[model samples]
Target: MEINVIEKIENPLLNRTEIHFDCTYQGEATPKVLDVKNRLVATLNVDKNLLVVHNLKPSYGEGKANGYAKLYDSEENLNKIEMDHVVMKNKEATKEEKEEAE
Candidate 1:
């Protein structure tokens, strides 16, 4: 899969960066969110816990998908703005938070 980003925004008040990318995604069962999260982490050299994959989708029959994501300054800020379901879907971060608190 290849990602071509078309938009990027940094919101200081939110303490996050918003990004939109167009991607050629082939794996049907793969969660694009995970891929996007990884890409953003590598690109920004930031912790995965601070990233949120908002949505990634394509129109029916199209292999190319549009994706949106945000990179937060910290896990707390991430939880503050992201939806509950989104936070739950990313089990990795939740587990990390638990380990950190222990």
Candidate 2:
């Protein structure tokens, strides 16, 4: 998959950066948030721990996708505002949380 950043907007009130991007991939399957997060981290030269890929959706039968993501100033700030399920899906589960879930 290839990622191209289309736009970036800073939300000072939220202490986050909002991103819009496009992805080109060579398969029918939809791309995952983890993979998108990795690409965004590399492209933005930011820490993976500070990035959260909130959404990625492919255009039907087009092999292209458009998505939005949020880059937080800190994990604590992120947790205070972002939805629980989005945080859960985008970040790696902590050891304690992993153990509890298991």
Candidate 3:
């Protein structure tokens, strides 16, 4: 899965910026919020003002199928990023797997 920032929004109350990503899944099963457990890799602006988070540790909410990601700042405030379900490839194969098959 590769995530690319599509947009960003600044929150007045939290004083943090939330980045929306164009999430794409090339795995077998559709990428769900549950699958993001400890697998989230913040590629862009991680060290800057924006702090990306996943699975809201300590209180893993009801394992919803369509749960989005969140962001925070140095103060530990939270901001929500609305994620939309995009195109997914069901029969994609990995490089190692393809090599072994051949």
Candidate 4:
């Protein structure tokens, strides 16, 4: 899969940077949400804990998807501004992590 960042906007009021991106996978299925989040963390050089994937929508009848993500200045701000389900969607929880969360 190839990811292209379409736009980035700094939201000072929210203490975060919002990103819009497109992912292209010529012959592959639409990537998983966690997979896309990991790629964004690596490509943007941001802490995974402070980044959240809000949504990723695959284009109809195409191997392309558009997504939105946010990079927060701190974990505090991230937790405060983002919805619980969205943050959880971006997390890659192992057995231990799942136990800890419970």
Best by lDDT: 4
Give per-residue CA lDDT, model 4, range 1-102, as digits (tens). Answer: 888999999999999999999999878888999899889989998888998989999998889999999999999999888998997888788999889999
| Alpha-carbon RMSD, each predicted model | 4.9, 2.6, 12.6, 2.8
Error of 1 at 102 (Å): 27
Report how far off residue 64 is in candidate 3 (Å).
16
Query: What is the TM-score (0 to 1) of candidate 4?
Result: 0.90
Q: Candidate 3, 44: how far from true, in Å? A: 2.0
Model 4: weakest 10-residue lDDT segment is 84-93
Local accuracy of candidate 2 as per-residue lDDT tens digits, 33-100: 88888888999999888788888888888999999999999989988989989887887667999899
Query: Which should have the higher lDDT, number 1 or number 2?
Result: 2
TM-score of each: 0.74, 0.85, 0.41, 0.90
lDDT of 1 by residue, 1-102 (tens): 677768889999999889887777675644457776787678667788877778888756666778887878888888878889997665465677879989
Best by TM-score: 4
Candidate 3 lDDT over 1-102, as tens digits, reads 555555667776766565555545553344544334223333553542234333222213322132234455653443233222211211135799889999
In model 2, what is the error at residue 62, expressed in angstroms?
0.8
> How well does candidate 4 match the true structure, expressed as C-alpha RMSD?
2.8
> Model 3, which residues run further than 4 Å from truth?
32-41, 45-68, 79-102
Model 4, position 88: C-alpha lDDT score: 80
Misplaced by over 4 Å in model 2 are 93-102
Superposition error at 57 for model 4 (Å):
0.9
